[model samples]
Target: MPHPNQLISLLHLASPALPIGGFSYSQGLEAAIDSGFVTDAETAEVWIRDNLLHVQAHAEAPLWILLHRCWQSSDHAGVAAWNEWFHVSRETAELRLETEQMGWSLARLIAQMGWGDEGLRAALLAQSPVCLPTAFTAACVALGVDAREGLTAYCFSWLENQVAAALKTVPLGQVAGQRILYRLYPALQEAVAEAARRADSDPPMLSTFSPMLGVLSARHETQYSRLFRS
Candidate 1:
């Protein structure tokens, strides 16, 4: 069991109000809508759920676990290597920029809040444009959050932001958005579990295999009258 304070810290980090600008980017969902892949609440739920299971579960979540371990052990080299890998893994320009901006924002916030030691903060800032999972994992390690709990929080934050984007762009009603989120609770758990298992592999193998999301995100860069950034 985690200490109450640690759990609280996880909640705070996961909060939608963290000011990392997570709400600004829709992570290609907007393009999905623009392209008619996601229109109503049902399609919206399916879109988000599929990405959550496929992309985040196989790649970002396991990457988060690896980054958490590296941060915990103070392996600056490993951290930088994985950070660069994640940056390269972003399939589109907007997607890449989203992580860079959000990660940069969170890195600065971590420094301002004094969450980690001088060395850890220095190492984190060393990455020219740290990816979100790298920066987020650093905070979790500094704050004493368990790896599993930290990844869970990360996924929840992503899910909440996706659902919020659906509400605005898909124009779903509040109740409908809630229903979408409510239905994906189990999928979220399964995603985290799969991420853990993947991370535990002898040498973790991460996938960036969501081609449709890549295409849609690229399309979003030129999307007309877009509501979200990506």
Candidate 2:
């Protein structure tokens, strides 16, 4: 059984209300909407699902697990290297800025609240522009969150945010949003499982190549009108 405190911490970390500014960014989904790639609930679900499966499953989830292990063992150098790797993996300026901004926000929040020991907290803040997964895994390690459970929470948070973005951008009804989220449950589970396998591979591999996301994000930079930043 997991500790109640750890469970609570996971919930706290995953909450959209965690003050990390996750709600303000559509992560290229808005651009996709602009391009008519995600006009209705069905298309919206497909767009979000594809990225969740292809980009996040291959990249962020497994990298998250590795970062978690690094934090668990107090490997600051390893943590820093992976953090930079994530920064470079972002294929667009908007995407890169999104992770850096969210990561910095979470790092500041955690440090202010004294979530970790002094030394660890100092090291986290030292990363300057820490990526989201690095700061998030650091929080998980500090709070005793199980690695697998943390990955689930991470992916779920992302799924919820994407669905929420779709609701606003695609202008879908509440029920439609729920339905999309409901249908993604299995894909989410598969993503978490794949992340575990990749993380445990003889030599872990991490890569994210969502070309449409890059193109859309770049176009969003000059989009005449937009709701979300990215």
Candidate 3:
């Protein structure tokens, strides 16, 4: 069991309502819907599940875990290297911008909260564009959240945001959205477990191979009228 304070901190960090501007991004879901790729609740569920398992679990989550370890060990150089790698891994401009913008927001939030060592915070903020996972990991370390718990919360927060985006884009009923989230519970658990295991291996394997999502995000960049930033 986690300490009560740590659990509360995780909840706060993972909350969708946490003023991080996460609500504005569908992460290509909107574009996918407009393109008829995610036409209904079932399809929306499939799209989100595929992303959770393939893109996020294989790529982003492992990085998030590594960032957590880096922050915990005061590995500032490792944090910056991972952040740059994450920036480069983005397949499209919009996708890159999304992470950068969210990273800046989260980093500012952490600074405002007065967490972490000042020197570490300054070093992170000095990065040209802080990525979300790195900023989130730094904040978790500062707040004394366990790396596993932080990673779990990070994944869950992403799951919640994707589901929320689907609710609007897929126009699914609230109950249906809840059902989809419930069905994804196992996948979420598996992703967290895989991320933890991968964090232990040297030269972590990071994948960025979602061709369709990349295309959609690229298309979304010039979408005539859009509800999401990407």
Candidate 4:
């Protein structure tokens, strides 16, 4: 078990204020809003929650844990192999762009911050190869966060970014956004706990059946009416 400060470390890595530039990418929430899948406040709630559970929680959170393990073992080569899986397995262009760009940004930030940690640096060694969650969890490890805490924070940050974007693009009222977050709290908690429990297992796996969302994100690249970078 980790010390209490481990939780603080995780929180720092997943903060909305983190230099990873996560706020700049809506993860296609903008496209979903355009397509009416996220027209209203309630729908926004569903979209964020569903996307987290089906996509980020399942698909990326496990990888965050895996990357954390890799960092712990100082296995930069293994980290690269996993990043290869992350890059090619991304189903669409926007998804690929989101991960790739954020990964590079995080790598750059690590250099500027002079984190001075070889393991963290190794995990994101390649420019275009590292995944977002991998980079995120790397910061957590550098700060002494536990692997499970890192995974939960990684998953939660996805939901936070979506809901925050919806507040701006949909112009959802503050009360409405808070309500949606509250409604998602239970599921979010369960997913986080589940992620923590499974952190040490064989590559963490989550569902990835959001092809329509993927299509919207890809379409967003050329979208003449974009409110978010995607």
Q: Which candidate has the highest lDDT of all?
A: 1
TM-score per candidate, in order?
Answer: 0.98, 0.97, 0.96, 0.88
Best by TM-score: 1
State the lDDT of candidate 3 residue by residue for 1-230, as single tens digits.
Answer: 55558988998999987888999999999999999999888999899889988889889999998888888788889889999999999999988988999999999988888888897799779878999998998988888898888888998888889989988877889999999999999999998888767767786877788999999999998888887898
Ranking by lDDT: 1, 2, 3, 4
* Tens digits of per-residue lDDT for model 1, 1-230: 77557889899999999989999999999888888888899999999999999999999999999999999999999999999999999988998999999999999999999997999999999998989999999999888898999898999999999999999998899999889888999999999999999999988978999889898889888887898889
- Candidate 1's error at 145, in angstroms? 0.8
Please give the TM-score that candidate 2 achieves against the real structure.
0.97
Pairs of residues clashing in candidate 3? none
List RMSD in Å for every model shown.
0.9, 1.0, 1.3, 2.3
TM-score of candidate 4 to 2 decimals: 0.88
- Per residue, candidate 4 scores C-alpha lDDT tens digits across 51-84 of 7666666656666677778777777776777777
Where does candidate 4 have its weakest 10-residue lDDT segment?
198-207
For model 3 the local lDDT of residue 173 reads: 90
Once fitted onto the true fold, the runs of candidate 1 whose alpha carbons sit more than 4 angstroms away are: none
lDDT of each: 0.93, 0.91, 0.88, 0.74
Judging by lDDT, tell me the better candidate of 1 and 4.
Answer: 1
Off by over 4 Å in 4: 1-4, 194-207
Q: What is the lDDT of residue 142 in candidate 4?
A: 69
